[model samples]
Target: MATCKSSSRTGLDSWQSRKSLSECLRHSLENKMFTDVTFKVGREQKCVQAHRLIVSIRSGVFEAMFYGPLAEQDEVVIPEVEHDIFEQFLRYLYTDDVTMDGASVMGLLYVSKKYDVKTLEQKCLAYLSSSMTPDNACVILEQAHVFDEQELKEKALSFILENGYGALKSSGVTDLCHECLVKIIQAEELEVDEQAVFEAVVAWSESACRKQNKDVTDENRRQVIGEVIKHVRFPLLDQKYFAKNVVPTNLLTDAEKVKILTHWICPNENVSPFNANKRTGIIRQEKIIIQRLAGLCGFGCSCSSGADHGIMFSVNQNASLQGFQLYGPYDRPTAHYDARAFITDPTTDDVIEGSSVTKSVSVAAGTTTYDVEFPRPLKLSKDKKYNLLVNINGPKSLYGKSDRSTVQDGSFVCSFFNCQKSKHSNKLNRYTDVDEGQIPGLMFLV
Candidate 1:
């Protein structure tokens, strides 16, 4: 009976076979073994040697070109594509891999598109999409549009929307089509302020004017600015800022400018509403702070504390609240540990209904920084102090510390402890001691 070495021996044999196959294929490509077709490409018309059977198996276009009526010819002229690109396409067919840089990726993408190599085309698209930046996004967008690459187009558009300020500053923004410019201007999430957005539109209109060889008349410029200006949040501009900056631009009609100015004087008048665009005002990104409490309360307790603990901060601007950050009871997770939050109008001391958001503690054995998410974005009002109350449950599991040295001026945290230890057996303990102090390390995202 013959004894088998092991299953590992079979695996090794398979690996060795694959390695040998790759080496043989590479060797064939290097030495032009069994060469069947010669491609004349590049400006200088250089010849690249390749095997018809290998390329035909990899690409449908190559299969037809190699086996069809043209198969009788030993050479093909591919003067439209560069020699390096043609060689790369051939290399991909033989080795199933391509090495491309940002500059060369676009060329390969075109070659892949022309040669009907779907896998290589997708790889090129992925590379271009990931490599997009402020400088190249507009150009990539135009190329994607021309090539009908819908996914790449969408990614480019999204990148423009998110980073429009930086992208618009790039000279390439002026080269975008009018429709692309419209989409960029209409994007509600564009991080630029309204004034910067208006200025970008002006610059784009100037480019449009130059390209069309038209005078920058009020009518022509207005036509160029056209419906795009309607998306600008003109109402958000200061009336004086509008007079000083926007009025002199001459992009607006005399009547239209008067309407905006008069609307500022009397919002209820016949003039167009400041929010004519019906825009949900741009919400600025700001970290609302409740200055940390001056002293660390030696207070450590279980999550079961009936009274909730959190800082109070006045949101000076109307904001879309994402969530709140909590500096938790440090050192380890405890079972039955749950933390919840509630919102209140501090002026009336009334709890706002439907603002309770909760989360269970995913405990680690050490101090944890918890980013407690709100159930939904809380629409906060301007100049109103809102109390964020954190109610916790569990025993000796949650603790809080206060850092007083970092005094942020805008907010304060309420301190509470079990002041009255219940005398009666039936009653639970109460946190009635109010030590209003600066509470740091707590923040809510706007």
Candidate 2:
């Protein structure tokens, strides 16, 4: 229809470049193979520059060459483009619809941003949000936040905060959640009362905060506190695993606290222990509680239900954390118990059980492992050192061949430990680990 700004009225500063560029493009396109190309605009006089603008192909797209002529909404042109982005752009120009895969669209997001192509930027943001892993989501969220794509930043922020300490406490994301919470609070410049806070934080159930559960559960209690602590989260990427065995849930015993600290310190698919929360803030802190918990713990009492949003909790022995975590290979030490050994806390150079405890277990490939898991509810304190040790008795004791080989011991004592007796009456125990294709003997302490 009509254009946003007439080039003649905007001044003739670009006249020289526009003239030369259009002439060069017309010269280049004259000999190209084109049967039926739309070239002329009815009302507009067929100027030399206008003809070049319509025929010139950039990154394989006719639209890139003659962008936003109808309005100011789409005038910017991106220069740094790969041949493939050009191809994709051309396809979009011809079809007006685009199918973007992860690898293909990542570069386009930068390109879109560079060109100020708001529509394309939004599309790429959606694509990135769907394709990202939790770890990658965290990284992307930070970048989106920095770029000030308000909508995209909000989406990424919600995904990053989707889960809280309580739901993942025993589920292995405690530390990660704690870290994200702390960062959000600090970024908002909120004040936290450290002494008023304690380690035993009890946030709400994950499903309780879900939108689908909104009509089912009265979240007024969570809502009032949410205003103060800002605990809303986006469940977009988090729900991907909701239906898979990767996210196991026992509704019958869902109320138990978690020993999820080691999860944050464990490696993820990208390798290296996931310090996802560290990317946001410190783990197991009150600021984390206030932000993620919505001051739920501080509203009334640590144990008060429906009144306290995720706020400060009464400090207790239940010390656990949660967040986006990475867990991969474990160190092969000796396995002590025939059952799986889990280390609640992950620390390096910490002596197990205050002694030089040495243990290793041989693993049976596809059958066994001394992998650690949470069998009980636990909460963690902030910046406190806690040791989660796994003891192995001898070869062939603890092992895992398939990751599904995980077993939970209900004694609430799945951890392997060494209780060194007095030198006069006892002997130091040494355990050995044998490789059987199972996960190696590993100890993770948070």
Clashes of 2: 74
- Model 1, C-alpha of 376: deviation from truth (Å): 27
Residue 90 error, candidate 2, Å: 2.2
User: What 10-residue stretch in candidate 2 is worst by lDDT?
Assistant: 292-301
Give model 2's TM-score versus the native structure: 0.30
* Predicted candidate 2 versus true structure: per-residue lDDT over 119-217, tens digit per residue: 677788888777654335544555565566677656655654432222223222222233343454334221112111111112323333442345323
lDDT of 1: 0.65
Q: Estimate each model's TM-score.
A: 0.52, 0.30
Cα RMSDs of all predictions? 16.3, 22.4
**Model 2, stretches more than 4 Å misplaced?**
1-32, 35-79, 113-119, 163-446
All models: lDDT? 0.65, 0.33
Error of 1 at 49 (Å): 4.4
- lDDT winner among the candidates? 1
Q: Native-vs-model 2 lDDT?
A: 0.33
